[model samples]
Target: EADIYQTPRYLVIGTGKKITLECSQTMGHDKMYWYQQDPGMELHLIHYSYGVNSTEKGDLSSESTVSRIRTEHFPLTLESARPSHTSQYLCASTGETQYFGPGTRLLVL
Candidate 1:
């Protein structure tokens, strides 16, 4: 089973606010990823990490940042929250296959 976790499964934030979505995995997988899902169910890669101190933005456009200081932790930060940033964020870890955490759904108004 996957040992990954995400806090505040649902969030309602005002526009211009700052929000941090927490993501952590106890599996020690070196590869961690974050994907953004639209309301219509289209998913897009937004950020990823390939081990400690290694992080890169994914294919999609995102205003968030990610950091990997410890192997079991990868957190995403949005400096300013907006209604455009309202979406479901999914965190995942990969070995031979990917294991996902329960997604965090954010609604910025």
Candidate 2:
């Protein structure tokens, strides 16, 4: 199994609510990333960090925020969740290439 894990693999929230999706890895990889993808859709990079405290927001994650205070944990938050935010969030980390998390599917009504 992949060392990466995501909480509340599925979520449903009212519009304008707030939520945080957690991602953690036991692989000890310092490089972490977040991607937004819909079911059966192409994954788009949203946020990434080269190492702890080195986060960068990608083009697709303009509305989201990420912080990297620890090497094994990278959490992404949406302050005001909307229907447009409904999608799958995937977390990845590097070893030889990259390892992916199970993915969190969110739905906003």
Candidate 3:
């Protein structure tokens, strides 16, 4: 409901393959967040940004890195994907309220 969109709604890739998860919002929010979740599990915050040029790692440690080059776009990149990295990635933005994208489901074989 956040007017946010995530690309590659589903993906299956081999181990060691580098991949990027794309997230974008049209609401012009200054705060954005990324979370990782497994099936029937709680979401873990992996990254967040207060605004453009300002990013911070979340409570959860992640091998993936993120960038906030623009206000509407926040992409997470995995230099090398692994089976352990397999999980669903969620993108969210906040103003007075939080909005979340549909999420991207990734599976590393």
Candidate 4:
């Protein structure tokens, strides 16, 4: 099983603040994904990468961007956060099976 971890489990920030949600996995998984979800809403894939240095935006349009500099690291960055960006950000890495991090809940004031 991949040990995925997300930092700042909960965040509360004022609008227009730039934030980066950190996601890391202990296991070396080539496929990684980032998803966004509002309370009680279904998860929407925002970004994904096939491997290090390969990234692609997901179906849902988002203001944030993601980069995979290393096989075990895929971080999502929001240049300027807004209230509408408030939601839970989930990170997952897939081997034979997909494993997810605890997720980061963000609130922009």
Candidate 5:
């Protein structure tokens, strides 16, 4: 199995609800990243961190927020999800090559 994990591989939710997308890596890599993507499209960088207590916003604009207080856990949260928020969220680490999770596919109505 890959080093990362994302639960609720698929989700259907109504508008304006808080949601947290889980990302955990067992590889023990210090760097982690969060990306959003549309089906069969390119991945958009949204959030990333070099290590614990370190965080930075990526090139893309996103309503989601993320934290890296723990070495192996980096989760993304949306205070209020909208239809525009609907997309796939991918998590990766800073290795020679990124190891990605299956992704969390969310659909907001």
Candidate 6:
């Protein structure tokens, strides 16, 4: 496999609820990334971390937050989800090469 996995491939929830998108990798990579994408649009890098205790915001605006406390796990959380937050969340980790998980599609109404 590609060494990356995301849980809850699809989600639909009402507005004003907390949600978390889980991302995990088995490659023991130090560089992890989370991207948001809409249908037929380019992926926007929202969050990234180089290593343990090293996190940085990417070149995009996002209401989500991520944690890289472990080398192979990066999870994103939204305090309160909204309709605007509906999008596809993709997680990736760089080994010798970059590998991306399938993704999680979330819909908030």
Q: In terms of lDDT, which candidate is strongest?
A: 3
Q: Which residue window of length 10 is worst by lDDT in model 5? A: 1-10
| Per-candidate clashes, comma-separated | 0, 0, 0, 0, 0, 0
Tens digits of per-residue lDDT, candidate 6, 44-66, equal 99999999988899999899998
Stretches of candidate 4 exceeding 4 Å from the true structure: none
Best by TM-score: 3
Q: Per-candidate RMSD vs. true structure?
A: 0.8, 1.0, 0.7, 0.8, 0.9, 0.8
Score residue 38 of candidate 3 by CA lDDT.
98
What is the C-alpha lDDT profile of model 2 across 1-109, one tens digit per residue? 6799999799999999989999999998989999999888899999999998899988774598999999999999999999999999999999787999999999999
Model 3 misplaced stretches (Cα beyond 4 Å):
none
Candidate-wise lDDT, in order: 0.94, 0.92, 0.96, 0.94, 0.91, 0.93
lDDT value, residue 19 of candidate 4: 98
lDDT of 5 by residue, 1-109 (tens): 5678988799999999999999999999898999999999999999999999999999999988999899999999999999999999988886777889889999999
TM-score of each: 0.97, 0.95, 0.98, 0.97, 0.95, 0.97
The digit string of per-residue lDDT tens for model 1 on 1-109 reads: 7899998899999999988999999887999999999877877999999999999999998999999999999999999999999899999999888999999999999
Between prediction 3 and prediction 5, which has the larger TM-score? 3
lDDT against true structure, model 4: 0.94
lDDT of 3 by residue, 1-109 (tens): 5589999899999999999999999999999999999999999999999999999999999999999999999999999999999999999999999899999999999
Tens-digit per-residue lDDT, 3-93, candidate 4? 9999989999999899999999988889999999898999999999999899999989999999998898999999999999999999999
Q: Could you give me the TM-score of model 4 versus the true structure? A: 0.97
Distance from true location, Cα of 71 in model 2, Å: 0.6
State which candidate, 3 or 6, has the greater lDDT: 3
- Superposed by TM-score, candidate 3 places the C-alpha of residue 47 at a distance from the truth, in angstroms, of 0.2
